[model samples]
Target: MKTRLSLFALLAAATLAGMTSPSALAWNTLNGQKPIVIAHRGASGYLPEHTLAAYTLAIQQGANFIEPDLVLTKDGQFIARHEPMLGGTTDVASRPEFAGYKTTKVVDGVATTDWFASDFTLAEIKQLRAIQPRANRDQSHNGLYEIPTLDEVITLAKTHGVGIYPETKHPTFHQGLGLAMEDALVARLHAAYGNDRDAPVFIQSFESANLRYLNTITNLKLVQLIDADDVNPDGSMSLVDPYRQPYDFIVAGDPRTFADLLTADGLAFIAGYADGVGPWKPYLVKTVADGVDRTGDGHLTINDRRVDGSTGVIEAAHAAGLEIHTWTFRNDASGYGFADPQAEMEYYFNLGVDGVFTDFPDTGVAALAAVPEPGTYALMLAGLGLVGAMARRRKA
Candidate 1:
């Protein structure tokens, strides 16, 4: 349980302290200030997801953390992408040669037919171009980017003075091929950032097996994604027939079960390995009536704090000694269920979730500044000089 981070990275991270996050300087400190500034898919609002250009721009935008959702290549190398398929987010289907790589599989209990990375090797994957997933977003930079490797991401972030928060996507599905994504990822992270679980970098996953395996591998701080399956008064990990087993067994005999994790005891067990929990948005504050979104708020909500304070999921997470963070925040019209970006974030802020994931950092940063203690902003500015000095010194 010993984690060690390089002093150089500490100085580099110092420049990112005092982010505009709601918690700001109240969160953990590394040598000084700096709230974790995670770039949602490499400043994705500005560029395509998982592209090196996107990651580079994020570092330039003063993001302390650059997120690269990890997927494995056919050769077992890890690359950044929101999912295994490249069709939706990248230009894959259009490619003539990769026609064979197109297929379908049930992912997270949902059927998806697209280009899967597991179907292609590293060489073939690099040949494809990444496109902006949202047409209404930005697309001017499309077709000019190449897929990047994990090492490439690390090296890029190192030069810009930042760390990556890599989430292991679909752990069990990938594990079926004897491909241990978490183990490989943690090993690489430790090799790159050293064996510091407390390092500025974070490794998170929706799968508890992924997180637990990471805990046993490296001291890197881990995070568990709490979704509908992770919660239930019955304390069942998952109602999905395959994921609800209670023994040291597998899903349809694959050697892992959703039931293996997600307990009051399971959450506690995870706390031993991770420092935070990224729960479903509804878990913290949602507006639901007969499973319908009533009133002005949307249906896919996470917490009910507008009135019932004790029933809020954020409070529950805090009671469990875990800071609450919710995922997939974006100001783009597609994600705003309440029909207003400002109002949406205001709802989350009122609920007291520790942090949020947003495609638009500027929007989130602005929202964070409006909160009570934006002490991290001061740290970020103070640290700015260091980052500039480093960037300049390197340039010189």
Candidate 2:
């Protein structure tokens, strides 16, 4: 079976072939003139996520930055994992030696019984091989790669001249385990790259307080990640749910939802402490339908969901002088109510998103290349006319 090129892929090829104006380059960001393509969990779609191999693959795919979601180990070492849970993304369950560590623990308020990363020392973690987190993805690479430490990920990025975008996954939860990710992250960054604002790094988190704390400690850029659960079904923001509010907000008894953080006042508050915001893609372009259970059975059914572009969140962020980088762009048609990854990316790009976190970096790169500048369509039309004339002459 032949593969069909995505719309963005065709656009990229045309742009490269001089069919579009030269100004139709990649999208611009606060980091640089070109839109940044962040490899979500390090080319996670190809290899085992958070592995050095995956990071290397993302770099090869032309990702401007590679993301590694950070979690703490038992011995207080910083390691890369989507979450502290080891069973889902590693072969820990198959090992008999670490079977004793299997127990239930509340992770970020949810009760998960697995071989938690916090329960294993850094040495113990090295013994286990990283596996594909999703069952649908290729499992051949599983057991072939090992979980990488933050230092290893940084070293890989440095060696390849790619930027590192590391997120402090479950910062409050890690702090409860006596392993404050902020301190470790700051110390590691300081030792390696110093307190340079322009350094090729961006530390991100879903929670707000830790980012505010890091603002006092380092000059490195910080991004605030927003989750889907932060928004209520009625289009209002919810603060009562733990997932909807920052853990610190809940701890301090503050009644504010993630939606509050996106307002002009809220963005001003974030601007006081952080460089940018990383919202879920839906926050920018939500699928709207009347009387339809978009969340039926707790999963978004693709039937009636239509991409009603721009929720004004991007404009609000840009107005606050804060860059916006949205998350988790995949080539598959599973969750994002759209068939074309290019269209989804282009929608965000047109909305002036500074960057995007995609599991497939190549797709993001292509989509960014497809975004045209002013007068690109005019040039495309002229090119098409010229091509038609040349074809007619050849036929005659």
Candidate 3:
């Protein structure tokens, strides 16, 4: 069985040999550049996330960037974990000795009862190990990797010559805990990569104020992440409670929802403080529940939703001079009318997303490779002719 990747490589190689113009295969991205593949939580689909091993694997997998969601520790140090909560992504729950650290605190308005990273010192944190939070993912590597600090993740990114897309997870919550990460994160990033706007670093945040604050302190690229709770059956986004608005918005009594950020006015507002916008994939494309099994997999699922095409967010962002990077493309779990994860990514890439945050970097890479660059239709037609000729020869 010839893999799709192998097939794409053959066609692409054949197409490239006769190409005269370098711009023949220009991408549809904001700057006509190839879309970047950011390894979300460091190739998270294949490994326990946020460990040095995971980060290293992501770099090895040809990711343009490795993402590390940053949270602070008790001693004012930045570490890579999905959130401050250690119960889900680490072995802290099983370690009886450090059991006293378990407690309840409201994180981004939800009362979360778990072992938080902020309660543990950097030295204490080292004793704990990483685990696969998702029950559906591989679990054999659960106790094998240690939780890595932000410095370690940065070092790995620099060594591999890849970019770092670090999200400041729950900035408002971290600030209230007296473990504010923005200042320390900026200072450390500036020290390592400098304050250059073109540095191989993009600091992302769900909170607007923190990114606005970051803009004044550093010139490194900042992305305002737009998030939503869920997608309604009618293809509308569910803007419920905490996930409805940036947590900081709730704190400041702002009434705008995450969906509002995609408006021309909202994008123009974002362009003031950030270089890019990272909306959840659903925000960029429209999908509708039309009662048809698009994938024909028995029952209708989110994957069976009818894809209606771009919702104009990408074009709007580009119009505002903001790059669009969407999130959480997983092979095991694809959403919104996409059964094939690679094909799903290709669709987004075709729609001109500047980057994609995927757990499987290799799939993302392969998908990007499969996209027909601008002016490549002639080459594809030729490749198809070549395939037909080969088939006829084999038949003879």
Candidate 4:
């Protein structure tokens, strides 16, 4: 309500939705189910990533929290974008006006050239429209939508009774711009959502520094992302080595590896700041076979039976009262996302995950519903009937 948006402006925008939704979903309202399914960039598989249309459809599809990758414009307004580059998610390459914006130095140790969001003011970005990036993926959504602002996203999410999980993309870089990305994001979110600690919204990031800073700023829940180690022969050693000494802690400035966090010492340290750890899929369950250990693309196999690696990283995190949710669950052939959404949710649910990052929330919600036994269903049905009767009496 404290947003800069005018009443009539919001009212006009609400008119576009045609139907107003309830407030945020209460976790108690989950009625005992699998982890919440957050749409990865708002049903990105079906539409252009981070567009209002993509976010809209995801809410209708039963996503508990719609995800938005937050990037700031030159004018200091935040927008939903996977990366600062416009070449992949938008029509910047085709636009001559933005050809000047095409330049890159190095990102995360990789040198690449592309159109950057920081170079383009919000006005220039508005001139470009969104298109599906992958050729093998759906391109029907090409040129259908424009990028949306953080304010636009929060408004849309509130109107639809959906929660938004925004990741502070490249935090270290944004802070370099003097924007103070996390402060700007949390201030805006709190103004609108009223600062409930477990308000169905989770602010996440790959970098640990942002999460740690956010812990000092607001009451909102924060998530830390962990990646896989390609060369580690033993997962336990890889996991434990991080906490052996006074190691580099933050993904920013220090750039410590995942091995640091997996250790008992690392986990105990991390639990001080975060409510959960969102690890890459590979580290959670490792597929294994007879004698020789197998490893390749699609999935990582970490079997403790032969490898002597206990999934104790998760246990360690959990014993410290942290939720262990794995991420980037997609539906692509690349196996980057979840293949069987139901089975994946079930697996994570069995693993005792508190949340899941999925490209499709509809599938995840259905899977969550299926987990409760018949007795739970009967109780739910009775509760619904009683609520219906009470509503009828009130109307009479």
> How good is model 2 by TM-score?
0.83
TM for candidate 3 is 0.89
Q: Candidate 1 on 301-351: residue-level lDDT in tens?
A: 422213232234555556567765676676764222345554565567655
Off by over 4 Å in 4: 1-34, 229-255, 291-310, 334-341, 373-396
Number of clashing residue pairs, candidate 3: 0
Q: Which residues of candidate 2, in runs, are more than 4 Å off?
A: 1-32, 230-240, 286-303, 334-337, 373-396
Q: Weakest 10 consecutive residues, lDDT, candidate 3?
A: 1-10
Worst 10 residues of 1 by lDDT: 302-311
Q: How do the residues 31-122 of candidate 3 rate in per-residue lDDT, one tens digit apiece?
A: 88889999999999999999998888888889999999999899988999988899999889899998998999999889989999999999
lDDT of 2 at 388: 57
Question: Estimated TM-score per prediction?
Answer: 0.72, 0.83, 0.89, 0.75
Per-residue CA lDDT of candidate 4, range 112-193, in tens?
A: 6988788778988888899887776789889879999998999999998888888888776676666579878988989987
lDDT for position 365 in model 4: 76
Q: Is candidate 1 or candidate 3 better by lDDT?
A: 3
> Candidates ranked by lDDT, best first?
3, 2, 4, 1
